[model samples]
Target chain A: MIQRRPDWLAGYGLLSPAIIIMAVMMVTPLLAMVALSFWTQQGFELDRSFTLANYFALVEPSSEPTYWMGIPFPLTYPVPAILLIKSLAMSLAITLAVIALAYPMAYFLAFHVRGQKALWLVLLTIPFWTSYLLRVFAWKIMLGFNGAINSGLKSLGILTEPLSFLLYNPLAVMITLIHAWVAFAVLPIFVSLDKIDRSYLEAATDLGDSRLRRFLQVTLPLSAPGTIGAALLVFIPTVGDYVTPTLVGGPSGTMIGNLIQELFLKQNNAPLGAAVSITMMVTIAAIVTLFLWLIGFRRLRSRAR
Target chain B: MQRIKFIDRMASGRIDRRTMLRQAGAFGVGLLVLPRLPQAAEVLTCLEWAGYDSPDYFKSYTAKHGGAPNFSIFSGEEDALAKVLAGFKADVMHPCNYSVNRFVNAKVAAEIDTTKLSNWKDVFPALQMASGVVMDGKVVMAPADWGNSSIAYRTDLVDPEYAKNESWSIFYDDKYAGKVCMLDNEIAITIGMMVGGEKYETAAVATGEKLAAAAKEWGTKVVKNSRFLWNDPSELQQALASGEVVAAYAWNDVYRNLKRENIPVAYAKPKEGYFTWFCGLTMLNTGKADPALAYDFIDAWLSPDTGKQLIEGSGYGHANMKSFEISDKQAITDMGITDPAEHMKQGTLLIQVSDAVQTEWNKAWGDLKALKQ
Candidate 1:
C-alpha cells in the first residue's frame, strides 16, 4: 500500500524569495562591514595590507598629551579607551533606567489590563510613527529653559526660575534615550508575560505559593529571555548612537560614538575610526555573550528541576 | 491505494524538476542583469558646514538650474575630511583656509582655473590669496566668506558693563567661567593659542609638548567653568536664552539671528583682535570630470547677486567686492563688518596642522575633557 505526500514544500518554495533577500541584504552587508573593519587606507588610496592597527587603536586609548599645571604630561590614556568606558557606562545606565521604568508598565499591560492589550500595545508604539530626529528635537524644545515644561512648572509656581538643568546635560540624554527606547524594552517583556499560561499560576497557588513567590519562580524565569532580548536590543544601539548624545548630551554627555564620528568624519582617519567601530563591536559583543550565557545557565537549571 | 500513490509520485516528480530548472534559470538571468544596471545619478556633492547651504538659498539655485546641487552637510572640517578620504566623491568641498593646504598637499583638490570665474576680480584680493587658496602658484579655491572668531554675549543676561569691555580676556575671566560657552572647533580653540601669544603657523605646527601644556592650562581654566562647548549656533543660542551661558565664541550670523529673534545678544570684536577662517570652494577630481559645470556653478555662486544674498541671508561678510557695493551697507554694518577690508586685516586665516601637531591637539582636547570627570 502507498500514502499521500505533504504539500508544505510548495509553501517553502514561495518563501525562497524572502530567504534570498535576507541573505543578500542582511548577511552580505554584515560580511562587508567585517571586511572593511580590517582594511586600512593610506593618503588618497586604500591599502589592502591586512593589519591589526585598526583593532588595536579601538582597544588602546589615543596617545595624545595630557596637560597638568604648567607642566605637560604625556598621558597614555587614548580617546578611544575613554570613549569605550564612557559609552559602556552611559549605555548601562540607560538600560537599567529603561528596565526599571518599563518592567512595571509591561506588567500592568500583561496582568492588570484586560481586553485592551492590543490598544495599549498600539499606544506604546505611537511615538515611533513620528520621525526620530523630530522626536529628539522635541525633547530639546521641551527641556529648553523657556520650553513648555519649564514654563508650565513656573506657571504652577512650583519653581522660582526656569530650570537650567533641563537641557544640554547627561540627564537630558538619559531622558531622551529612555523615551526613545521604552517601547523596545516593553514589547518583548509584554509578549513574554502574555505567553504565560494562567493554569501554571493556579497550580502555584494550589501548591501554596504566595503571589511574590509565584512571580519570582514562574513569571520572572519565564520572562527572562524576553527581558534579556530587550536589553540587548536597546543597549547595543544606544552605546553607538551619536545623534542623541550630540543633540542632548552637551559637552558632559558626549560619548565614544561622537569620537568615532570625529575620527571618521572630522579627522579623516579611516583606520582610527574603524578601530573605534571594531572596539565598540567587540565590547558590545562580549557583554551580550555574557548576558546570553547567564540566560542559558538559568534555562538549563530550570530544565534540570 | 496504488492509484493514489502513482498520482502523488507523478505530481511530485513533475513539479520538483520543473521548479528546480525554473529557479536555476531565474538565478542565472538575475546574476547577468544585476551588474549591467546603471548606477544612481552623478552628483557634484558639496560637503559643507551648516548655514553654507541652507534650504532657502539652495532652493533658489535649484529653481534657476532646474535641479538642486547635492550638499552633504558636516559640522566640523575634520568630519568633512574624513568623509572625503573615505571614498565620498564630492566634486566641490568647503574646507577653511587653514586646511586648504593639507587638502592640496594630499592631492584632494584639483588645480582650479581662476580665469573661468568671471567674478574672480570682485573677491577681496587678500582673502582670495589667503594661505589655503594659492599654493605653489596654483589657485586651489575661490574665497567665499571670511569672518573673525569673536565672542557673542547676551546683553540681556550678561551685565552690559562686563560685555562692553570688548576683550578676549572676558572669556577666560573667572567671573563668567561657569556661564561661558566656547565653540567646539579647532579654529575657535586656536584663538586660545593666539591669546597665549602663539601665532597661527606656530600653533598650527606646535609640537605635542607645547600643545599639551597650553591645552592643559587652558583646559584647567575654562573646561570646568564652561557651561557648554557647542558645535551648532542653535545650541549656543539656546544656552544664551536660557541664561545657562552668558557669553560664547560664535560666528557673526549666530549673533545676528539672536538679535533678529529679539534675544538681545551682541557680538564684540575683542581687543586682541579675532582669529579668522576663510572658506573657499575647491573642485575635486572625481574620476568623471565636470569642469565646465563646476566652473559654471562656482561663477554663479560668486556672482554679485549670490554674494549679496549670502550676506543678507547668512550674515557672513562676503569676499566679493561687487557684493559690498550691491549689499545694504547699513545691513552689512549691523552684521558687524563695518569696514570689510579692515576686518579682513584683523582676521587671520587658519592653517592646517600636520599629523604630528594634530595628534598633540587631540591629546590636549582629550585631557581637557577628562578633567571634567
Candidate 2:
C-alpha cells in the first residue's frame, strides 16, 4: 500500500512556478535594489562599501528645502521628498477623479442595461486598444497650442492666438490620467456592483427603506471593496509614473519619478537613485497602509460578510 | 539628435527574423566570392543611432564585406553606453563627443586603428583630435556626422532686436516666458552657464563647485521662465513649427526640417557662439565580429559619397572634409557645419567634463531640472 503523499508537497508543487517567478522577477531585484542602496557610485563603478551616506543624504540639509504650493519641508536633500509629495498629491487627485467618473458608467452597465452587456464592456475597452502612449499623444494634440481645441475655437471665432495654457501643466496631466485610468477603475467596480444580491435590496425595501436609503445602506456598502481596490489599482502605478508627467507635466509638473530617472540614467548615480526609489516605495506603502487603517478594512470586509 | 526618433520607430519595428535572414543571405552570398578571406564572411554588427542605419551610409562596407553590417539601433547615447557596458555584443557603436569618454574609461571601447581607415586623413583635424577622440594618443572614436546645439527660433515671431544678436539669454526673457522651450539635459546646464557669462570652454566652469551655485541659479532662471524642457529634438521642432514656442534649444536638423516645411524658422547664431556636437563610430572591445571588417564599416561611413547623402538626405554635417565639396554649399553654410574647432572659439565644443566635475554638473543639472524655484 502506498503511503499518502505529504500534504505540503502537492501544495508547493502547484505553487512552484509562481513562487519561482516571484523569487526571480520581484524578490531578487528588490533584494539587489536594497543592497545597491547602501553602496556609493564613483563614476560608473559602484563602490561596494557599506555606508549610510545614501540614506543620510536624503535629509542632509545641503541646500534649501523646497516649498511646493505652500507645503513646507524644513529639512531634506533638495530633491526626493518634495517630488514624493507632489506625485502622491497628483495620483490621489487622479484616483478620485477616476472613481467619480467610472462609478456611474459601471453602475449604469451593471443595473440599467437590458442586454448586450458584452458590447458595452467592449466599448469601455476602446481607449485601451491603442496604447498608453498613443492615448497621451492624442491628448497632447488636442490640447496643444494649435491643437484641436484651440483650432476649433478659432474656427468658430471664439477667440484668437489659441489657449497656450491648455497643455503642459498639472491640469493637463490630471485630465489625461483620469481618461487613461478610468477604464481600469470601471471594470472592477462593475463586477462588484453586478455581484450585489438583489434580494438584499428587496429585503431592505420590505423593511421600509427608500430606494436612495437602500442604495446607501446596502448597495454602497457592498461595493466598498471593489471601489477601494479600483482606487488602489489606479493609485499605485500612477504614483510612480514618469512618462505621463514628463510628457505633459511641464516644469511645474516635475515629480519624484522623473527625479529618480535623472539619478539612475543621467547622473549615473545608481546608489542615490536606488535610495530615492526605496524612499518613494516606503512612503507609498505607508500612505496605503494608513489609508486602509483609516477605512477600517477589517470591519468593512466583515460587514460585507 | 532630432533626426533620431523617426529611425528609432523603424528599427524597433523591423529588427525581426526576416531582416536577419535577409542579412544572413547576403553574407552567405559574400562568403563564396571571397572564400579565402574568412573575416569578410563573418558578419559585423553596428550599434548606430536610429536614423543612421540607412544603407547609403554603409554602401562601401557592404561592397567589400559581401554584406552590410547588421545594425542594432539605439535612441540615446546614454542608452548606447549602458548597452555596451552590459556586454550587448555590438561590434561598433556611434557615440557623441560628450559621451565617448565614458566608453574609453569603461574599457568597452577600443582604440580604433585609424590607419586602416583610408578616409581618416580627410576627416577634420579638429574633430580627428577632438578631446574624446584622441585620449593619450589613441583614436578612440572614428569621427562621422556632427551638428550644432543652438537656439532654433521662429524668425517671424521673435523681436528683431533679439534675433539680430541671438543670445542664450532669450530663454530667460520675460517676453517669451512660457513660450520658449529649453533642452532638458546637461546641455541645458552648459547653456545656463553661458547665459550667466561664464565660458564653459574654460576650466573655471568644470573643475569644481566654483560655479555650481551659479549654474544652479542660471538653471532656475532658464527653467523657471521657459515653458518646458524638451527631451526629443522633434518635440522642440514641433513647438517651433506651430509657433507655440518662439524659440527652443534645438539641433541644426530641427532648423532645416522646419525651414523645409516653410515654417519660417531660423538657426540662431548667438553672440556667445554655437555649441558644436559631433558623433562618430567607436569599435566595441567585444570582438564579436572580425576586426578588419569593422574598420571597413567605419571607412564606408567616412566616404564622401555616404557623407553627401548624410548631408543631403538626413540633413546633418558629415565629418569628411571632402563631403562639403559635393553637397549644396548654401545648405552647408545655412546649417553652420563649418570646422568644429573654429566654432569652438566662438562657443564651446561640448566635450565630456572630468568625472569629478561631471558629478558636480550632474548635481547642478539635477537641481536645475528637478527644482521648482
Candidate 3:
C-alpha cells in the first residue's frame, strides 16, 4: 500500500492569477510613477527629457535671505525642502495625538469591559459612518466663533466675546484629523491587545510582578508590531492629505501637500510635483524599512536566548 | 506505486500549463487594446463654472437643440486647466479673461473665428483686449459674464458708519480681526499689493521677484489678521450667516442669496477700486462634434432674453448689453453697480500671471505664512 505525495505544481497554478494581477495593477503603476518623475512638460504635452532639475530644485536652498538690516529684506522662497519638513512635522503630530487618545480607549474595550466589546466598536465607528466632508464641516461649525461651543461658553459668561482661536488654524486642522483618524488607530491596537495570551499575564503575576510591570514587560513588547503598523497607516496618508488643511487650515497652516496640489493643478508643473511625490515615497519607504529591520534584528537576538 | 505517481505528475503538469497560458493571453490582449479606446466624445463638452449651467438656465436651450450640450462645472480656472491637461475630454471651456492666455499657450483652446459668433460686437471692448484674453494676435474668448469683487458685510454686526467708507484698510482693522473674512485666492491677495502702491503689471509678464516681494508683504498682513480664508462663496455665506464673520471679500451673488434668505448683508464700495474678473466661453480643439452646437449654445446664452434669465438666476451681470434693458435697473443698483460705466472705469481687471511670477507669488505666500504671531 503506497501513497502518492501532494503535487507542488498545482499550488503554483493556484497562485498565478494573483501574481499576474499584482504585476499589472501595482508594479506597472509604480514603474510609471518613477518614469514620470524624470519627464518634463513642454507646454501642455509631456516631453521625455531626462533631467535632474526637478530633484535639484527639491533639495536646493533659497537664493537670497528673507530680510536684511534696516532695509526691507529680499523675500525668502520655500523650495521643496521646506514643504517636506512641514508635512513631516504635521503628519507626526497627528499620528502621536491619535495614538495617545486611542490606546487607552482600545485598552478599556479589551481588558476593562467584559462583553459589550461589539457595542463599543460600533460606537467608535459611528463618527466615520457619516460623509468625510460632512464630518469635517460639522467640526468647522462647532469650532467657529459663532458655533455652539463659543455660543455656549458665551451664554455661561465664561468669557466676554466669542473665542477667536476656534477654526481655520493649525489647531483646528490637528483636532479634525485626530477625530477623522481615531478609528484607524484604535482597531489595530485593539486587535493587538486581544491577541495577548492570558497565561503570560498569569505567569508574570504568579512570580509576584506588579500589574504595571506585567504590562510593560510582556504586553507592550508583544503589541509593538501593531503599534508600528498603525503609525505608518496614519502617517503616510496624513502626509499627502490636502482636503483637511484646505478647509480648516488658514494661510499659516499650509502644508507640502497643498504645494504639490498647486504645482500640478495651478502651476501646470507635473514634473516638479512628481519629483516631490517620489521624494516623499522614498523617504517613507526608507524609514519604514529601517524600522522593520530593527524589529527583525531584535526578534532574532531574543530567539537566540 | 510507479503507475500512481506517473498519473499524479501528469495531472499537475496539465493544470499548471493551462492556467499560465490563459493568464498570459488575457494580459497581452488587455494591454494591446486598452490604450486605443476613444476617450474623446463625439459631442462638444463644455467645462464651466458652477452656476453657469444651472438647469433653469440651460433647459430651454437643451430642449430646442437636437441634443443638450454636455457640461461640467469647475470650482476655479486652475481646476479646469488641470482637468484638461490630465486628458479630460472637452470641446469648449469657460475660463475667465485672466486664464485665457495660459489656455492658449498650452494649446488647450483653439483660436475663435469672430465671424461665427453673431453677437461678437456686443462684447465689451475692455474684455475683448484685456491682457488675459490675447493669444497669438487673436481673440481666443468671447466674453460671457462679468462681475466685480467687493466687500460684503453683515449690516447688523458691522457699524453702519464704518461700512459706508470704501477702504481696504477696513479689513486690517483690529475691530474686525476675528470677524473679517477674505478669499484664499491670488487675486484677492494681490489687492493688498495694489493698496500698497505696487505698480500693476500683467501676471503673464511680471517677474518672479516682483510677485514674491508682493506676496511676502501682503501675505504677512493677510494671514496675521484674516479670521478665515474662504475657498467658495458658500463658505463665505456660512461665515456670514453664522456671524463667525461680519465682513468678507465676496461676489454680488453671495449678497443676493443672503438678502433673499432675509439675512442682513450689504456690498461695500472700497475706495482703492474693486478688483474684477471677466469670464467667457471658447471652443477647444478636442470637440469632434458639430462646432455648430457650440456656436448655438453661445448664441443662446448671449441673446437678450436668455441673458436676462441667466443674470436673474445666477446674480452675475450679463455680458450682452441688451440684457441690461430687460433687467430691472433697481436690481442692478442693489448689486452695487449704480453706474456700470463708471464702475467699469474705476475697476481693475485681474490678469493672468506667468508661471515664473506665480512661483514667486507662492514663495511670498509661504513667507507670510511663516510669520510669527
Candidate 4:
C-alpha cells in the first residue's frame, strides 16, 4: 500500500492566507476592542479589572423628556442612542436614494449601450477618481452660504441674500452621501442586471406580457440580489460614517461615529467608546438580520445557488 | 540630491565605473550576508506643530549642531499627547499651557533643567510662571509662544450694535443665525461659561454647580446659530472672507490674515476676556538624545531672533519679551502683541482641570454637541 497525501491539506493550505490575514487584520482588532470595553480607564492607566460601569453609564437615565417613539433609551446618556437612530435613519435614506438613482444608470449601461459598455462604466466612475474629502469639499463650496449657487443666482437677480437653508443641514448631508456612495451601489446592481438571461425576458414577452410587466416580473426579480447586496454594502458603512456628517451636518450632522471618536480621542474614555461601538454593531446586526429574514433570505440565496 | 552626490563623487574621482560596480556588488553582497539592523535613532526629534519646523526657529541650534533636528508635525496637542503616550519618541514636544500638566501627569514629559537654557530668564517671567508650565518647583515646559482665542467678525457684515459690545453673546445672537463659525474645543466651553454669566474657573467647570443650565442654553443657542464648527484656522478665515459668516471664534492669526487681505475684520476684545494659550516645549523622558543638545535647541527657540520671526510671520506672541522691541512694529500691532507683557499679566489663562471635571465637561459637551444634531 502506498501512502497518499491528504487532500484536506491542499484545501487548508489554500485557505490559510485568507485566514491569517483575517486573524491579524480583523479578528485581532475586534478582540482588542471587546477586551477594552470591559476595562476601566483612570487617567492614563487602564485597570484590567472587569467592570460593567461603562456599559451602565451608556444607559443611565436622566430627567429629560422621554424620546417620542419610546425607544427605551436612557435620557441622560441619550447622545449615543439618538445618534445611532439618526445615523441609521440617514443611512437608510441614503441607501434608498442611492439605489433609486443608480438603478436607472445601471440598467441603461446593462441593456441600452450597444457598444463601449466599459467606456460608459469608466465614464460613470470618473467622478469617483478624486479623493472623497475633495468631493465633499466641492459640495461644501457649492452649498455654502456665499457659494457658487448663491453667487450665480444672486448675479441673475434671483435673490438679495444667499440662502441660509442650503448648507450645514441634513439635506446637504444626505445629498453629499448619496453622491459619494452611488458609485459603490452602481457596480453590483449593474453586474446583476447584465447577468440576467435574455431568454427569461423573451419568455415573459412570448407570454404576452408588456415591457413594463416583463420587467416587473422577470428582470426585477433576477436583479434583486445585486440591488440588495449594494444596499447592504452602502447602508452598513454609511451608518458609521462621520466625515460627511461632520463636514455638512452642522449642528445636526454629528453621528454615532463622531461620538465614538469623541470617546476615544477627546473624552479619553476608550472603554465607553468600545462599548458604544459594540452596542452599535449589535443594533445594526439585528436590524440587518431582521430585514433579511423578512425578505426571505434563505429562498433568495438558494435561488442564486 | 542623490544624483548630484553621485555626480560629484564621480567628478571627484572618488567613484568611476569600475569602482561604482565594485561598490554596488559589495553592497548587495553585504545586504544578503549581514543581519538586518535598525537604523540609528535620530539625535533630536522635536514633535512640533506644522510650520514650527521652519529652520529659522532653530537656526542657532542648527549652526552649532551642523543640521536641524528631526521634526514631526501634529495639528492638535491632544493628538500629540496621544502619540507621545503611545510611545512616539521625541526629545521635545510642544503642548499648550492647559495640557502641560496632562503630559506631566502621564509621565511622558520630563522636567527641564532651566539652568541649561540661557534664554529661559528672558522669557516673560509671567509666562514662565504660568500655572501648568511650572509644577512643584520643577520646570516641565519652557514657555514659547501664545495665541488668543476670540471672535473675528466682519465689520461690514455684522451689526454695529453687537460688535460694539465686548460680549461672547455675539455667538448666540439670533440675528446671525446660520452665519457664524465656532471653534470646537474646550475654548468653546469657556465661551459657554461666559454666556452662562459665570466666571470661568476650574471649580465651576469641574463641578457643573452653576454652569449646567447655562451650558445647555449656550450649547443650544450657539449650535443653533453657528453654521459650522471650525477645526482649522484657514477654514474660519475663508468663511469670513467669503461673507459666509458674520463672525467666528478665531485665533489671532485669522485676524491678522484677514487684515492683510484688506477684509473689514475686527478681533473682539470680549468683556469675558480672550482665551489666551501658552504652548511650549517639554523634554521627553524617553529621549536618548544629549540633554545639552535638547537644551541648546530650546534656548534657540526662546531666542529673541526666533521670537521676532515668530511674531512677524505667524502673529503669535513669542515668550521672549525683547522680541517685541525688535519685531516689525506694524506686524506686532497686527498680532495684538505690542503690549504682550502687560497683556500676559492680565490675561485670562486656561487651566488643567481635574479628571473628574474633564469627564463632566466632556459629557456635557458630548450631550450638547449631539443634542441639536
Candidate 5:
C-alpha cells in the first residue's frame, strides 16, 4: 500500500525546468518592464515615481495638428502610438505576403521534387549563411540608385537615368524582409506539408476528387499548423525590426523599434521606452490570442487527423 | 607514415585511453600559456574613433613605454559617454569638445594636469580652452584633432560659382533632388537651424513646440530633397565617388579622402558657416592605469609627429599648429585651410545643447525622416 502520486505534482515536476526558465528569463524582465512603464525621466535621471504621465503623453495630440500628405490630424497621435500602428500594419502585410508566397514553394519542395531534397533545402538556407546585416546591405547595393539594378539598366540602355524609386522605400523594405524571412517561412511550412501522409492524397483522388480539390480537402487543412507557425515566426520579429528600415527604408521607413531605441539608448528615457515596449508587446499578444481563438487550435488538430 | 596513420586514427576516434590522456595533456598545457601569449606587456588602453586607434599614432608612447596601447572605439560621443558612465574605464578617452562637458559634469573624466603634458604649449590657444575642455579652473581635456562639417561636393558635377555661394540651403535645393545625402544625426538639425537663420544661443534651449515647428519646416525640407540619410561616412563617400550624388553634407575628412583618390571633390565654405568640432583626449576618473602614463599618452597624441600623421594620413587638423610645417604642402593646400584657428574663426563651433532641446531634435528628426511630405 504505497501512497498515491498526485497528478498535479507529477505535472509540476515535469514542467519545473521550463517554469523556472520562464520565471527567470522572461517573467522577471517582463515584470521589470511593467514597473518601469509607470516611472518617469527628468533629463538624464530616471525618476522611479509611479505616474501615468508617459502614457498620457503617448496619446496626446499636438498643439497644432497640421495635415501632411492630406491625412487628417496626422500629428494628433504621439510618436509611439503612430509608429506602433504603422509597424503593425507593415508586419501584417509582410506576414500575409510571405505566407502566400511561401505556401507554393513549400508545396513544390514537398511534392514536386524527386531527388536531392537535402541539397535543395541547403540551397534555400544559403542566404542565411551570411550575416543578416551583410545580406541587408547586399540588398542596399542592388537597389541603390547607383547600384546593380539601376547600373545594369543604364548600361543596357533600357533606362537613360538611374531609378531613385528602387531604394529607400517601403517596397524595398518589404522586398528585403521577404528575402531575410523566406527561409523561416519555408522550413516550417515545408515540414508541415511534407509530414502529410501521401495516402490521404491518394484516398482523396481515388474518390474522384480533382488535384486542386484534393489539395483543398486534405492537403490544405493538414498544413494549417505549419502556416500558423510560419506566420508567428515571421510576424513577431518583423514588427520590431529597425535595422532593415534604418539602412534601406530611407526617410519614410522608420519603425517603432527605432523610436523605442532612441528613447532608451539616446534620450535617457527608459521609462517611456519601457511603456512603448509593453504597449507593443500587449497589442501583439492580444491580436495573436484573438486570432488563435478565432481559428481554434482544437479544430486545426482534429482536421489534421 | 605509421605515426601519421596512428595520429589520423586517433583523430577519427580510434584512440586508446593512453592516447586520449596525451591529447588532453597537450590541450591543458596550451590553455595554460594562451592567456599570457600576446599581451604579456602592460596595456595602455585608449578609447577613441576608428582612425585614431592605429599603433602608428602611438609610436612615441610605445617607444617610451616599450609597448603599444590597447584600443577600443565608439562611433559617436553619446555611445562613449554611456559606456564611461556605465563604469567602462580606459586610460584615455577621445571625445569632441561639445561632448566633453557631459563627461566633466558626470565626473566620468578626471582633470588633466597640463604641467605633465610636454607638448602643452605647442597646442593652439583656441582648442586649449575650447568649450568643455576646462572645468573648475583646470584643463580636463587636451585638444588633439579638429574638423568642420560642411557640404562635400563633386566639383566636376556642380558649378564652382553655385557651390561657392554655399549655405545649408544647398541641401534644400531641388536641383540636387534624389542626388544628395545628408548625415542622419541630431547635428543635421543644426544645419537646418543654420539655414533657417535661427540664432544658435536661442535654438540650443528652444521650447519643444518651437523646436518642433522649426524642425518640421527645415528638417522636412532637407529630407524632401535628399536621396538618402547616411548613417556611416563611407556611404556618402561611395555615393559621391560613384557620381550617384553630386553633393552631400559631409566632413572635411570626406573631402580629403576624395581628393586623395583624385575624385574631384571639394569642401564648401557655406554662407551659413560650417559646424566646427574639436576632438581631444580626456582622462578617465575610474581608470586603473597610471596617471603619469595617461599624461604621456595625451602628450604623444598632441606631439608634432602624431599631428603630422593626423593632418596627412587622417586629413583632420591637429591642435599643434607646428605639424602644418611637417605636413606635405600639397596635402595642406588640398585641404583648403593651412591655419585651423583662422578657419575656426570663420565658422561656428558646436556647443552642448540642453537635454530637453536634444530630445525635441531627436523626436522631430524621427518624425521628419518618416514623413513623405
Candidate 6:
C-alpha cells in the first residue's frame, strides 16, 4: 500500500532550495541590518543596545546658527533627511529621463524596425558589455572641461571657450545614469511592447479608431507593467548610487549612498551605516509599493496569475 | 594573444594535425583525470597597499625563503582593519597612524616585540611613538612610509604670489571659485578644523559640539566653493592638468607625478600646516602566524635596502633615515621632504577622533554637500 502525499508537500520540496538560498543570502543580512540599526558605535566599539538614537541622529539639529546673506538660518535640515529627499528627487528625474529616452528606442526596435531586430538589440547593448565603472569613467572623459565634447566643439568653432557646465554637476550625474542604466529600462519596455498582440491595433483600426486613440485605449494600458518595471529598475538602484555622484557629481551632487559609504567605510560606524541602509531600503520599498498601487497592483497581480 | 600563440604553435609545426588531435584528446582526458590538491601555506602574509607588494621591497625575505610572502592588498586602511577584525588572518597588516588604535583596541593587532626587530631603531623617532603606533609604552606598530597631504597648485594657473602665501583658506577663496578641488575624505574636515582656528589637539579629538562649531565655520566657506571633490588619483591629475582646477588639496605623490611630467605644479607648504600621515605594519593577533616569521617580515620591510627600494620605486619616504642616504639631496627636496624630522614636526598628523566626532563631522559634510546655494 502506497501512502498518499499532500500536493503542498511536493511544492515545498520543489521550492526548498530557493527558499533556503533566499533565507541565507538575503533575509539573514536584512535581519542583521535591522538589528544593527538599533545599535550604537563608539570609537572602535559597537554597543548593542535597543535604542533609537541612530535614527534620531538622522533628525538631530546642529544647534549652531548659520548666516546666509546676513540673515540668521537655523540648522533645521538634518543631513539624512536632506540626502534622502535629494536622492529621491534625483532618482525620480533619472528614472523619468531614462524612460523617456528608452521607450522610443524600444518601441522602434519592437514595432518599427523589421530587419535584424536581434542585431539591433545586440548593438544597443554593446555599451553595457563593458564594465559600468569603465562606462562612467568614459562619461567623465567625454564630459570633462577639456574633454572630447569641449575640444571637438572648440575645433569646429562651435564655441570659443570650453564649457565647464557639462561635467561635475547634477546634470552630469543624471546624464551618466541615463546612459549607464537606460538599457535596464529598454529591455523591460521592449518585452512588454513586443508582447502586445498586433491584432489589437488592427481591431482598433477596423473600428475606425485613430492611431493615437488606439494607443491610448489599448497599447498604453497593455504596456503599463513593462513601463512600471522599467521605472522600478532605474529608480531603485540610481537612488542609492554613490559612484556616479562621487565621480562626476560635484559639490552639490552628493547623494545618500555617499553618506552611507562614508559611515561604513571611512568613518567606521557600521551601526549608522546599517540604519541608513535600512531607512533607504524601506523608503525605496514604500515608493515601489505606491508606484505599483498607482499602476493598478491588482491588475498586475491578475496578469501575472 | 591566444590566437597569436595558436598560430605560432601551428607555424612551428612541432606537431602535425594527427599528433595535435591525439594530444588534444590526451589533454581532454587529462583535464578529467586531474585531481584537486590543497594549496601549500606561504609564510609572512601581509595585507597592504598596492606598491608595498613589489618584489623589490621584499627581496631579502623572498631570496631567503625562496618565495614571496602571501599578499592580500587593500586600497584603504578602513577596509584593511575591517577585514583583519573580521578574521582575515594575515601575519602582518598595513595601517596608517590614524587607524592603528582601532586594530590595537580590537586586539586584531598584537604588541610588536621591537627588541626582536633589527631595524626598529632605524624607524623615525617621532613615528616610533606616533599617536597610534605606541599604546601604554608598547610599540604595536613598525612605522614605514610617510607622506604629506598638502595643497598642490598648477604653477602656471595659480598666481606665484598667492601660492607663496599658502593658507588652508586658499581652498575656500572665492577668487578661485570653480577652479578649486578638494580631497573627498574626512581629512578635508580636519583641514577645515585648521582653517577654523581649532588647535591640533582639539582638532584631533573633536567631539560633537566642537565638530559642529568647526563645521559651521569651515563648511560654509570651503565646501560650497569646491568645484569638485576627487578621490581617485587619475581624476585629480586630469582636473589639474586640464586647467579645470588650479589648486587642489592633494597628497605629495600628486606633486611628484606632475613634476615628473614637467607640468609646472608646486606642492604648497600651507601656513596652517601640511596634513601629514604615516603608514606602517602591525602584527595581527591571528594566533595562526609564526611570531618569528612575522618579526622577520617587519624587519625586512624596515631594512635600509627595502627603504631605498620603496623611495626609488614608489616615490615615498621610508621611516628609516638610512634610506635617505641612498638618494641625493635634489631627490629629497623634490619629494618635498628636505628635513624629515622638521617636516614631521611642522605638519599636523591625522589621528583617530572619537566615533561621535566622526559622526558629527560626517553629518556636517553631508549638510555641506546638500547645501544647494
TM-score of chain A of each: 0.84, 0.93, 0.86, 0.92, 0.88, 0.89
lDDT of 1 by residue, B107-224 (tens): 7789988898887988877777666778888889887776666788878777778665776666667888668888765444456666777776676566666766666566556666
Model 1 achieves a DockQ score of: 0.30
* Candidate closest to the true structure, highest DockQ: 3
The share of true interface contacts that also appear in candidate 6 amounts to 0.37
Candidate 1 stretches with Cα past 4 Å from truth are A1-48, A54-75, A298-305, B1-21, B27-43, B55-64, B126-130, B199-201, B220-223, B287-289, B312-315, B332-341, B359-372
lDDT, residue B70, candidate 4:
85
Looking at model 5, residue B262 earns an lDDT score of 97
> Could you give candidate 4's per-residue lDDT for residues B1-373 as a string of tens digits?
9768765555444544455567567878988999778876458988887667889898899999899998888656666776676567778998877877778887888889898888987888777777778988889999888877788898888878766686787788788787888776545656776665667674345456544766666776787788887766777788899898888988777888898899999988888777777888899886778878789999999999999988887788898989888999888766644555566556677677765766676667667777674
Q: What lDDT tens digits, residue by residue, belong to model 3 across residues B176-271?
A: 776788776666456776677653454324455666565556655666677767666777787798787888888877887888889988777777
Q: Write the per-residue lDDT of candidate 1 for residues A1-305, one digit (tens) a residue.
A: 32433556545554667989999998887676667667786654567677876776444443555443233334365556665777788889999989888899999999999998789999999999998999999998898777889999989999887787777767898899989998889999989988999899999999999999999989998887788878888899999888987887776677888877766655555566766776688889998899788878878897899
The docking category that best describes candidate 3 is: acceptable
Return whichever of 1 and 4 wins on lDDT: 4
> Once superposed on the true structure, which residue ranges of model 4 sit more than 4 Å away at CA?
A1-3, A66-74, A297-305, B1-40, B43-76, B86-91, B202-206, B286-297, B333-341
**Which 10-residue window of candidate 4 chain B scores lowest in summed lDDT?**
B10-19
Better of 2 and 3 by lDDT: 2
Q: Each candidate's DockQ score against the native complex?
A: 0.30, 0.25, 0.34, 0.22, 0.20, 0.17
TM-score, one value per model: 0.85, 0.86, 0.84, 0.87, 0.86, 0.83
Model 1 chain B is weakest, by summed lDDT over 10 consecutive residues, at: B6-15
Off-target runs (Cα >4 Å) in candidate 5 are A1-22, A66-70, A73-77, A297-305, B1-47, B61-75, B83-92, B159-161, B199-201, B286-296, B334-340, B370-373
Error of 5 at B55 (Å): 4.3
**Superposition TM-score, candidate 4 onto the true structure:** 0.87
Candidate 6 chain B lowest-lDDT run of ten: B6-15
Better of 1 and 5 by lDDT: 5
The sequence of per-residue lDDT tens digits that candidate 4 reaches over residues A66-115 is 45245555466777888888889989999999999999989999999988
Which digits, one per residue and each the tens of the lDDT, describe model 5 over residues A1-305? Answer: 32444455445544666999999999999999899999997755668889997777777667666554354453454567667777898899999999999899899999999897899999889988899999999999999878899989999999998888888888888889988998889999999999999999899999999989998889998998999999999999999998998889877777888777766755556788888888888899998998888789678676799
Q: Candidate order by TM-score, highest to lowest?
A: 4, 2, 5, 1, 3, 6
